[model samples]
Each structure stands twice: as C-alpha cells, then as structure tokens.
Target: MIVITALLIVVVLTLAIYLFYHHQCRLREMAFLMGEAVRNGDFTFRMPRKRMFFGERALLKTLNDMENNIGRLTAQNEVESWEKLTRVLTHEINNATTPILSICQSYLASPSIKSSPYREGIEAIHDTTSSLNIFVDSYRKMTQIQKPDPVELNLLDFVSGVACMYPSVQWHIDISSAQTLFIDTNLLRQAFINIVKNAIEAGARNIGVRWNRQLCISNDGAPIAPENARNIFVPFFTTKSHGSGIGLPLSRQVLMMQGYDLSLAQMPQIGFHVTFIVSSTCGSC
Candidate 1:
C-alpha cells in the first residue's frame, strides 16, 4: 500500500509539471506571433482564444484590441505625414513659380517683345505659367486649411441647408435639432460638401446621413473597389477622368486640423453601396 501511494503521487506531479510547461509554451508562441505582426505592420490578426486560461484569454483580448487601436493610430500618422509633405511642396512651388511668373510679365511688358518674333513664344510661356499657378492654388487649399473656430451649432439645420444645395437628390436626414456639435461651421460645411459632391459624382441619386457622435453619409452609387479604397485619401490620386483629385484630400486635411477624421468604412445598410464616416480622432465626440 505504501509503494502504491508513492507511485500515485509521482504520477500526479509529473502530469502537473508537463501541463505547466505546455501552457508556458503556448503563451510564448502567442507572444511571438503578436510581436512579429506588429513588427511587420500587420494589425489584422487576432490570437486564438480557445483553450486559453482565464488570464491568458484576457491578455489575448487586450492584445487584439490594442492591434485595432494601433492600426487607427498608424492611419492618422500617415494622414499627418502626407499633410506636412504637401505643405512643404506647395510652399516651394509657390516660391519658385512666383518669380518665374514675374519674369514672364516683365518680358511681356518690354518694348522689344512688340517687334520680336519671340512674342508668341513669350505669350505661350505666360499662358502656361498662369495655368500652372491656378492649378497650384487649388492644390494649396489642402495646405492652407483654417484653424477650427468651434461654436455651438445645430446639426439638423446645418444638414438641411446642405441638403437644399442638392435639390435633385433625395436626402434622408436622421439628425435632430437636439443633436449639436461645437465645431467650425464653415469648415465642416466645406468638408461635408466635398463628401456629398463625391457621392453625386459617383452617380448616387439617393443619399442618407445619420449622426450620433460621428457622422455617417451613405449613398447607393457604385461601391468602392476593395483595391482602391486604401488609396482614396492619397493626395492627387483619383480614378475619375476629370477629377481634380484634391477634394477628398482637402476634406481630410480640413477635418484633421479640426481634430476629426474621414474614412471609408463598411457600414451596415441594405441599399447604400458605400459609406463615408466622419469621426473624431481625439475620441472627444
């Protein structure tokens, strides 16, 4: 009986030791996966939750949530980075182009040009430079966004006014008079206009808008291709033939300066093909 009791105790200890090592190995593998994913800039992974101990499961959930938030942070950082690059480029272009434009004007005004066969060539240069200036001015809008002047504003009235602008399209507004925001009215209006204009340009004849803390604008126009959605916020990138390519980029810059963000999200609705959500990056509202 004594020998049998010792044998049973030995078996229990061995099993416990083996199970503990297995658990440690499982946790270490999960940690390695998380580290590798973050290092590779891939935040779309979720660690398996099955067979995990209570504390281990909690850790897994937290890591998954952190990955989501990290992805959002990365996106915001990219937006700011592009905005800074655009500002520097636009400033440099303006500095270089202004002097060239002035030189062209001086040449055009000189008396020698009247009889010179080079008059036509000089005029061509003037025309080309003028057009370039105009184009750059439009691109500069992305850089010269105004600082937000927040005010107590009504959402219902504001959206109703915008809906009036597109009298042809049917607008479904789900906002209320009580739903208000402390924001720069004009700046937000400009941003909202660009969003709606893009929907209209996409052939959306019907539009719907709903707001709680964030704004969701949906349209039945063509759905954005999965491959193209990621590049929508990129400056000067557009799929449209006549697109100036600055509308969405400028809207994003305006909202970014105002502590907000615009994203193409897969929102739930049966009829709408695409939804652009305007949310606060600061999590204030």
Candidate 2:
C-alpha cells in the first residue's frame, strides 16, 4: 500500500511539471512574435490575449496596450513633421519659382521673341515653373488647416447628412447604438466627403457605414490592388492618372491631429470589398 501511494504521488508531480513547461513554451513563442513586430516597426500587429494563463494574459495585454500607444504617438509625430516640412519647403519653392514665372511671362509678351528658337526654350521653362508653383501652393494651403474645435455630435446624424449629399448612391447606415462623438464638424465632414468621393470614383454603387467598437465605412467598389496598398496613405503617391495622392494622407493628418485614427482595413472586411476604419484615441474629448 505504501508503494502504491508513492507511485501516485510521482505521477501527479510529473504531470504538474509537464503542464508548467508547456505553458512556458507557449509564452516564449508569443513573446518572440511580439518582439518581431516591434523590431519590424509594425506596431499595428496585435497579440491574442484569450486562451492564455493569467500571467500570460496580463503580459500580452500590456504589450498590446503599449503597441497601441506607440502607433498613435508615431502617427501624431509624422503629421506634425510633415506639416512643418510642408510650410518651409512650400515657402522656399514659391519664392524661387515666382520670379522665374514672371520673367518668362514678361519676355513672352514681346512680339520680337515669338519667332526666335530661344522663345520655345523660354516658354518651356515658364510652363514648368508655373506647374511647380501651383503644386507648391496647393500643398501650402494644406498647412493652413485650422486647429480642430471639437463638439459632441450624433454619429448617425452626421453620417446621414453626408449620405444625403449624394442621393444617387445606395447607402447603408447602421449606427443604431446612436453613440455621440466629439469631433470638429466641418473638418470631419470634409474628411468623410473625401472618402465618399473616392468611393464614387472607384465605381461604387453601394456604401455601408456601421459602428462596431469603431466606425467602419465599406463600399462595393474596386478593391485596392496589393501592390498599391502599401503607399495608399503616402502623400503624393497616387495610382490614378490625375490623382493628387493626398486624400487619404490629408484625412489621416486631420484625424491624427485631433487624436483620432484612420486606417484602411484588409480586403473583404465585414463583407465589403473596401473598408475604412475610424477609431478614437481621445476619450471624452
């Protein structure tokens, strides 16, 4: 009987040891993945917290929260840096190009130079300078965006108003929870308009908006091609022939300045070909 009891005790001890090691192995694997995401500078990657031991769950959650904070701060910093750079570059570019444009125009106004070969060269210079000036001016205007003045607004009301602007398109609005968010009316309206315009340009006949822990806008439009997805939010990187390439970037900038986030979700999100997500980092603001 003593030997039998000793054998049972040994078996229980071995089982406990195996279970402890198994849990530790899973924790190491998850920690390795989280470290990889940080090293790659991809803070958007998230780790699962479910089905984990108490200690493991706490650690995973803490890591996820850190990632979220890092991503938000990084976005805000990028927007501020871009705005300062735009201000300086636009000022210098306009200063340098304006005089050349004027000189070329003044010379072209003379009839004697019309038949000269140098006339064509001067004209080309004028044309190029003019284009540069226009581009610089457009970017300069973006830097003048007003500081946001947030006010509490009904999400459904605001979004419905946007849909009303385009009666031709089929709209699906679902913010049945009727949540109120604090945001700048005009700026957010402009951002939403930009998004809707892009959807229309992409040949979308149906658009859907819903609230599921965040605001999601989906469209049955042409999906973003894989190759172009990486640069879709990059300033001045448009795939369209006449695209200014600043719509998404500007939208992100405005939202970022106001402590909000704007991102494009992976394909087929919530049964739509294209999805845009808007989430808040500022609570009660």
Candidate 3:
C-alpha cells in the first residue's frame, strides 16, 4: 500500500510538469502571433482575453497597452512635425516674397526711376530670390534624408574622427575600447559635424565626448535659455543671427530614423550637453 501511494504521488507530479510545459508553449505562441500582428500594422487585432494565471494575464495586458500607446504617440508626433514644418516654411517664404514685392512695386510706381537708379531695385530682387532659393534647397535637404546604411564601428574611432575635423577647438575624449555601435557612418558624421559647429558657434572653448552607458557630447559653452531650449528641436528655430536652424532638427531626424535618440540637456556641473541614447533592446540601433 505504501509503494502504491508513492507511485500515485509521482504520477501526479509528472502530470503537473506536463501541464506547465504546455502552458509555456501556448504563451510563446501567443507572443509570436502578437508580434506578427504588430509588425504587420494590425493594431486593431488583439489577443483574446481569457482567464489565465496572474502573470500571463498581466503580461498580455501590458503588451496590449503598449500597442495602443505606440499608435497614439506615433500619430501625434507625425502631426506635430508636419505642423511645425509648415509654419517654418510659410514664414520663410513670406519673408522672402514680401520684400521682393514691396521693392518691385516701388520701382514700378515711380516711372521716372526706370533709369539706372532702378538697377538697385533689380539687384535687391535678385538677392532676395537667391536667398529664397537657398532656403528652399536647405528645406529639401532637411526633408529628404537618405536611407541610412549602417555599419558596426568602434566608438573611440568614430568620435575621434569627427573631433579631428575641427582642430581649432580643444577636445576631450573618454570612450572604452569595448564600446562599439552600429550606425550609418556618412549620416552620423554629418550629424556630428553639425553639433560640433553649433558648439563652436556657441563659444565653446572645449568639447568633450564621453561614453558611459549612452554617448554624450558636451561643450563648455553658455547654457541655452529655457525658452530657446524648448524650441531647439523645432525646424528653423535658432538664436544665431545667421542660423538657418535646420542643422539640429535634421540631425535629430536622421538619428530617429536609425532607431536612436538625441536630446539636449543642461547639466548641473556646467556647459551644454547633447545625449545620444542607444537602447540595448533596439536590435536595429
């Protein structure tokens, strides 16, 4: 009777183990299906809610909420970006056109001024048209970023190469040998150049590149005002006298396309900081 009781206990344990394994397999299958749906842009397709263990139920709910959040955020960002772009473009075009119109009307209204004196108005129109062309070309460049072709790179080499481009400024590099990342070399180089130039223009005496968990480029320059910092990422928003203001915004767009993030921060210590976020779970980044 004791042996029979022992055998019965063993049988019960085996049955429980098999049930747990089956449940795990189901979970994995569900996860895969959910992933596929998300990849295919089927946000409306949701997993069936059913009575399950607390852990599994909670996990599924979390995933559902994530899908909804992502969808909302993506839509909101697109709308905001386009709205900002439109505002900047309209303002720039009006600035260019208004001057040209006023100058031309004045030139035409004065028939006696059709002599060589009118040549000044013609020159003004030419200058304004040239400036407008330049603005349009810059806008095109901002909107039409080429698809990035990424390659693995050593952090030290990449940062050093960019720093070397600006020999006039002092550079402080602190990166580990093991710190490597994958990025589009050409595109990232452009972004880095823009930031370096911006720092130099901001009167930075020394620039520092450091790699802890994420990459940070800092400059010993005056901190940006709270108001300016808020609009720093907006296209055509610049405090510089001659700044076209597309540099930072375009750099950010390029980085975002490559599944990375860039942002400006003012550290308590001193100087302006730009953070490059590299996510561990972002396989493409």
**Model 3, position 272: C-alpha lDDT score:** 39
Error of 3 at 278 (Å): 6.3
Worst 10 residues of 1 by lDDT: 276-285
Off by over 4 Å in 2: 1-22, 39-41, 114-124, 266-268, 282-285
| Every model's TM-score | 0.74, 0.83, 0.60
Backbone Cα, N, C clashes tallied per candidate: 0, 0, 0
lDDT of 1 by residue, 1-285 (tens): 999999999999999999999988988988898788777555545589899889888888877777767765876677678778878887888888888889889998999987899989988988898888788788767767777899988988999999999998999999977988778999999989998999998999999999866788899888888678778878888999989877887787777676677777644355799888877665222
Which candidate has the top score in lDDT?
2
Candidate 3, residues 68-185, lDDT tens digits: the string is 5564355347535754676678568867677776766677567676666766767677677767756676676765679999999788989888877889889888899778878888
In model 2, what lDDT does residue 11 have?
99
**Cα miss at 165, model 3 (Å)?**
1.7
lDDT of each: 0.81, 0.82, 0.70
Query: Model 3's lDDT to the true fold?
Result: 0.70
User: Which model, 1 or 2, shows the larger lDDT?
Assistant: 2
Model 2 is weakest, by summed lDDT over 10 consecutive residues, at: 276-285
Best by TM-score: 2
- Report the error of model 2 at residue 247, Å: 0.7
